[model samples]
Target chain A: MPKQVDHEERRAAIVSALWKLAGERGLDRVSLRDTAREAGMSLGQLQHYFATRDDMLVFAMDFISKRTTERVTARVLALDERTPEAILRMCVAEMLPLDDRKRQGSRMSISFYVEALDNERLLSHAREGSRKLLDFFEQQLREAQDRDEIPADRDPRREGMIIMSVVDGLTSYCHLGLHTAEEALAMAMRHLDTLFGAAHETKR
Target chain B: MPKQVDHEERRAAIVSALWKLAGERGLDRVSLRDTAREAGMSLGQLQHYFATRDDMLVFAMDFISKRTTERVTARVLALDERTPEAILRMCVAEMLPLDDRKRQGSRMSISFYVEALDNERLLSHAREGSRKLLDFFEQQLREAQDRDEIPADRDPRREGMIIMSVVDGLTSYCHLGLHTAEEALAMAMRHLDTLFGAAHETKR
Candidate 1:
């Protein structure tokens, strides 16, 4: 159990190194040798955890995606008012690149997104993650509808997809510096306000 | 004059080759040598047109952006009813990867977008294009508001940005095959419906 814990720690360190390199330079510029140097390990040691560049990328993406889910879940659980509408807003906010750490996460996700466009393994991995998020959003929308917070006629699945797209688009613009993170979050709030009915003001 | 024309043609041919390679293998995998070979030319010939990989990428991006603008313009002009709603829908449809050629274009753009996250020159180039597009969208929205087609209280610039973001998010999803082109277009139309008011049914 101790050795297993050590292995996990080392892998986490390498992935952290990968993120550092990817954040400063785009993900495409990352190489195993450079990552190993950044992690203060030999290439051979890095290879023990990741056999190839793709292997390293896939592992890094999984790590970040899981971490993001955990972070978002924790934030939602700690919220004072966890109405369906509030929960959805919290999730959307978490998805946006609102600060430095979140921005780096967004950058890494965007890189993987582009890579996923052509790589089957990465594409499936991304799709699975997206599917899970969409299902969760749909569930929240359904809950809102049940509580009469949103129109009953609205399709939860479609609404969830639109919310996802808006958040994604805002994230892209934020990364490009075309819109500030604050501006993006405001836009997302506006969209949610329209969806949840103008009468339901956010308690936050 | 013929020599100048030939020079332009050769550059076009090279860019075309780059697109083909990029569309199939992703842009990050493309190299000057590979592009030259794909174009049925030599490395020297390719280097003559593009001194560096960045030079090639910038040129190719410019070429593609110009072509996309011209095509979208043509489609908009051909529309029978050029209302703000109609025009915006047409532009959004053109932006989506609804077919083979467009899918390839989106793939290339996505790759460039990732690159632009780190490269200043490319970032500026991308921002310039996005600014122009946003301005165009805002103008259309302003006209709509003036005509009382959309609510006058809505901010034209902000609405334009939201439209752009929704379309962009949909485009990314479409490329990933998470949503078919048709599904993305439907989702975009729904957003427009909500924006333009429920009474304004799309002519198309």
Candidate 2:
């Protein structure tokens, strides 16, 4: 029997190398040839996986988001039966760049954001990803309100926007060295507590 | 007598053309040759003002920041004898991309931010500008506390950080079309009111 190659694994390896190069230099330095060199693969092999540079970038961003979602899922599962506030706090904290890996992810995200400003395909992917994250947070906030874990008067949509804004903002600041990862997480936690904890306390 | 060339005006024109090109295409597309073409100047003439690509980018970013500071100063001056909260609210709202001009400024900022990730000289300029903005907010917050305009127990540093984070976050969201500029300004205003207005009201 002929040996079968793991295409998914190969692509993942390419993305990993792409991120390393992007982090060391800047996202501006990423190119199909350079990515192939970094991945130790021939340009033909990289082209076999990613048709174009934008395709590779889109895949890289998707891969990062998927990895983040997996980590978030595991954290949520570990906190089984926890309050909505607890789950949200965990989710938001995990979304922050709390480690080297996540910081690199955040840098990649900034590149995506800046590129999306002028690239339609990348812009659509970014918008879709942002919309999904916003929707997930909105659903959680709505459920929290329903359970009275958060105040009933809270607007899930608005709060969702706020949560997303805070995460993005803090991550950027953390990347800039204005704040440490620990401080960013702590500040996010405090913001959440003020939003969820204060309302519940006042109601009680 | 030779015609007096306005060197400052010439540089401003180059920076304006830079922003226009950067806005239409991604920042990566910006080059000395392209910028010269877009600005309708010979490459040699462009080199007279900007020796390198980095030099041009640094100059463009500084020009944007100086323009913003000028607007902030004008707004503050217009609100003569206003409360700290009023001045701050105005400043925060003004900092957001509420119109075409400000949005272009924000786009340029995002460009600088991404480039700064790898370029040390640009990164230092970005850091210095960020520090100055943060310091300005901290000073305003401290003055507010001293004047009893806000709660005495408020932490100026923390509040300043929160305000900056919120402004930066909202601006990014606005750029992404996640929220309208009006909504972004409203959210930021509400956040500021919560921090300064509510506490002082209760005290009274």
* Top candidate (DockQ): 1
* TM-score (C-alpha) between model 2 and the true structure: 0.90
lDDT of 1 by residue, B1-204 (tens): 444448889999999999888877778788999999999998998899899888999999899999988998898899999999899999999998899888878878888888777788888888888988999999999999988888665788888988998899888887776889999999998788777873343532
Q: Please report the TM-score between candidate 1 and the true structure.
A: 0.90
Worst lDDT 10-window in candidate 2 chain A: A195-204
Docking class of 1: medium
Candidate number of the best lDDT: 1
**TM-score (0 to 1) for chain A, all models?**
0.91, 0.93
**CAPRI classification of candidate 2:** medium
Candidate 2's residue-wise lDDT over B1-204, tens digit each? 999979999899899888888887767678989999988999999999999999999998888888888988888889867777778888888888988888888877887787777787888778888878888889899989888776665578767877888889888878777789999988887777666663565663
Pairs of residues at least 3 apart in sequence or in different chains that clash in candidate 2: none
Clashes (backbone N, CA, C under 3 Å), per candidate, total 0, 0
